[model samples]
Target: MDVLLVEDDKWLGQAIEIGLTERDFQITWVRSGAAAIGELQRQEYQLLILDLGLPDIDGQRVLQSVRRKQLALPVMILTARDETDQVVQALDSGADDYVTKPFDLNELAARLRALYRRRGGHASAEIQVGSLRLNVNSHEVWVADDPVRLSRREFDLLQLLVSQQRRVFSREQLERQLHHDETPLESNALEVHIHNLRKKLKHKDWIETIRGIGYRFSCD
Candidate 1:
């Protein structure tokens, strides 16, 4: 999923971005509040990670503006402030969750997943398509009651397609979702992932390729 990371600490931001990317998150990191607001206006993201101690404007003001504009995406506050009143204020201002600094990455990832699932109206961690079941939290896939191991990218590709069945995704769209902005993608890199996914799933017609268009998960 696409995530907007609003952080000013270069080292911390890079570490968080790398960690999230490894777990199949597409991130756009911005250092200042102005940049964060601009990105939010120009692009779409599934989640927002905002640091309250921003360089340009206060993070609370940013969150207030997002709510005033009626942006419904989930926002998680990642800041050093751990006071009770601060957490309450953030939640009241439309923040979904708050994680203080010096936190555990794994815990943060899990919280993000929970928020994501809730936003999608899923009460459970599992998403089932046809005979395939995917445990979103665990990153485990099962087909017809048999376990199937998938590489990180392969699983991410399948998850994206399966979650939005019948919606076609173009090559450029998939590439952006699967890769970071700084990473150069090979011409065949996406194809290779698609091929590997189909092979591993052993279902030839599950994912349909539209000539000159894109790919879609077949409901047939």
Candidate 2:
């Protein structure tokens, strides 16, 4: 999933960016609230991780602005403030969840996944379409009861396509979701991933390319 991380602490930000990227998350890290807002306006993200201590604008104010603008983006507050009132305030301000500074990266990723699942209207981590099954939390995929091994990028691409079956995702959208901002992508990287996924799944028609448009998941 594509996530926007707003943090000012260099060490913490780097740690999160690296850790989440390793976990198959496309992370766009920004140090200031203004940059975060700008990115939010310019691109699409599945989730947002905001830190209250920003050098420019207050994180809470950013959340408030997003809500005021009626952006339904899921937000999780990552801050040092652990008080009950602060947590409540952030939630009331449109933050979906709150995590304190000294937190486990695994737990943070899990929370983000939960938020993403809920936003997608999925109550569970496992998503099943026809004979194909995917467990988002476990990072597993199965076709006709046979376990399928997939690279991280391949799994991400399949998960996205299956989760919103029939919806055509443009090549650019697929590329953005598969890679982060700083990563240099080859011209045919997406095609390579798609080809590999089809081979691994043993079904070429499972993912349909729309010629000039994009690709869509189809079991029919």
Off by over 4 Å in 1: 124-220
Residue 121, candidate 1: Cα error in Å is 1.7
TM-score of each: 0.56, 0.56
For all predictions, the C-alpha RMSD in Å is 16.6, 16.7
lDDT of 2 by residue, 79-106 (tens): 9999999999999989999999899999
The candidate scoring highest on lDDT is: 2
lDDT of each prediction vs. the true structure?
A: 0.89, 0.92
Write one digit per residue (lDDT tens) for candidate 1, span 1-220: 8999999999999999999998888889999999988898898788999999999999999999888774678899999999999999999999999999999888889999889877757667788988999998899999888898998778888888988889999988888767855668789989999998888888979989988988988755
Report the C-alpha displacement of residue 164, candidate 2, in angstroms: 28
